[model samples]
Target: MSDNVTFDAIVLKELNKPLELVKGIQFPDLKKGQVLVKIYYAGLCHSQVMEARGHRGQDPYLPHMLGHEGTGEVVAVGEGVTKVAPGDHVIMTWIKGSGHEAGGCCYAGPSGETINSGGVTTFGEYAVASENRLVKKPEGIPFDLGVLLGCALPTGAGIVLNDIKPEKGATLAVVGLGGIGISALLAATTFDPERLIAVDIEQSKLDLAKEFGATHTFHAAHDDWEAEILALTDGKGVDHAVEATGLAEMIERAFNVIRPGGGELVFASHPKAGDVIRLDPFELIKGKQIRGSWGGSSKPDRDFEILADLFRQGRLPLRQLLSDTYTLETINEALEDLENRKIIRALIKISEPPADAA
Candidate 1:
């Protein structure tokens, strides 16, 4: 093993600030039941941007590393470990402290202690993971794909497939067609829907949504969205609406466009802290549901492999969902693409050694 090896990592040096490349992080002495993973790929998710913008939290604490979607091989393990061994490829799912589930406020509450305790500190070269935290990467699945399964796909698909479970041939709508929204669209493809509508502020994303399985694509900023969605459903309203943008207004709109007894899935984390959304009680009384999905309510160890198999069989076309790729050093540019809606699915490429291992 290479002792005292150092590597560069993008870090959040201040709250509401830009990320900077830094070096010289000391590898922690592995404690019992912990494993050290040499990160090969890390996705720059919107949540990380929230953290950088001080939306996840405020300063002093703001300076900590901020990456949750991590995939790599275990290089070392501490005493009493058994889930995975050194050299085993794995995906890191974010669930801090302790929690039985990954998505939803209830599941997220228990994780507060963990996130508060230390897991928020992982956007570095080598990340410390619990034995159960790492899910084995499937054969032939690229590291980029592995990291996405940990959160993006599961969260997106999990919301529709796991949480909302829209009825077969039911009309559906998804707002904010970014990573999560795109995954939701892909997930919609598996289950035949009467109508699948994709909504985003950008026309480029709306265009991409069609490729992901959307039957109709519309700009959320346009005045005709509600009318258009209703018109598509024959004015009956959709059976389910998924809010993936994390904006309060969009979530409220999702509630409005769904029919009585329809389901709404909130998948995005809000851009600002303490942002409140207003809703009417009559809507809920009519059997309308508003729910938050965490990592798509994914049980990674069990569901990820199932999803991987689907990907391999061509049931889920993950390749089409990916629109851009970036190297670790060029992370900001990748994120800029995300901000500009130039790309729907973006993966940060970890410059790897030759395909044949040493």
Candidate 2:
């Protein structure tokens, strides 16, 4: 528990290439509004994949850390910190919260190189995070399950519960069954949509969506999937649509499924760089609104508690969220699994959990 901590981490030294695991990297001393955390469980997201593959464009921050969501124990706190203290279990998130904004950190690499880090990076054994990026983990939620609260739940559930705010018995459809898609589908069921539709290329995910309260399911593998949805809605469209896949065409398709009058579309997915989504200008005339969601426009300090309560009450089926688990050494495998669509969410275990927590 000293300022000179050495740990292993996944660093993106080159874009569109496998991340490098640099061991014995020296962590810098915590600055004002900073907190040092021993990372336990982290979630692998498509955002990291976007950063690693240079899909989001530009790589001025190469050899930097990757990961914006995870769970960890606060080992120490820096000056002017008040939100959380040392030894308090907390959730690591990219969503800014109520605390100081200590900027990114600089670490001394093994070979005299420097590794840049953001206010919150979780793909390592330890993290030096900004105090505003940390939120107290509710005791009712285990560390493994709490990891989802960092990004997936906030963005996924936040979209339906916060932005769209569909009325009871309304119609809704969630396209794509990845972490965010599945989370949106799970949250949409709470509203009791008259026709809660789920769409995905994989039958397994479609079947799983049904178990989580989707009234109807569609396979996007078919060319006429959108037409089928329109048919199901009697030539109309759902009141709201959530596009969770980061494909430009899918976002446009999701927008098309929205009803003309006062229909809304919210997408949480991020398409690759230079990917443009073209929409018919006439849709706007029809009262069809579309907007991109930045972490579901979530306020983590207030939302995490509400989300945690839902999880405790069994309303959120988060126990089954993670599709697979991997160690830090197998980080590449985790990313590959995510890219291949083999898993909904991959849990990266930087350090082993305690006996009871496991």
Q: What's the TM-score of every candidate structure?
A: 0.88, 0.98
Over 36-73, each residue of candidate 2 has an lDDT whose tens digit, in order, gives 99999999999988898889999897789989999988
Clashing pairs in 2: none
**Candidate 2 residue spans exceeding 4 A from truth:** 1-4, 356-358
TM-score of 1: 0.88
Regions of candidate 1 where Cα sits further than 4 Å from its true position: 95-117, 120-122, 262-266, 353-358
Candidate 2 least-lDDT 10 residues: 349-358
Q: Each candidate's root-mean-square deviation in Å?
A: 5.5, 1.3
Hey, what RMSD does candidate 1 come out at?
Answer: 5.5
Model 1 lDDT, residue 115, Cα: 20
The lDDT per prediction is: 0.70, 0.90
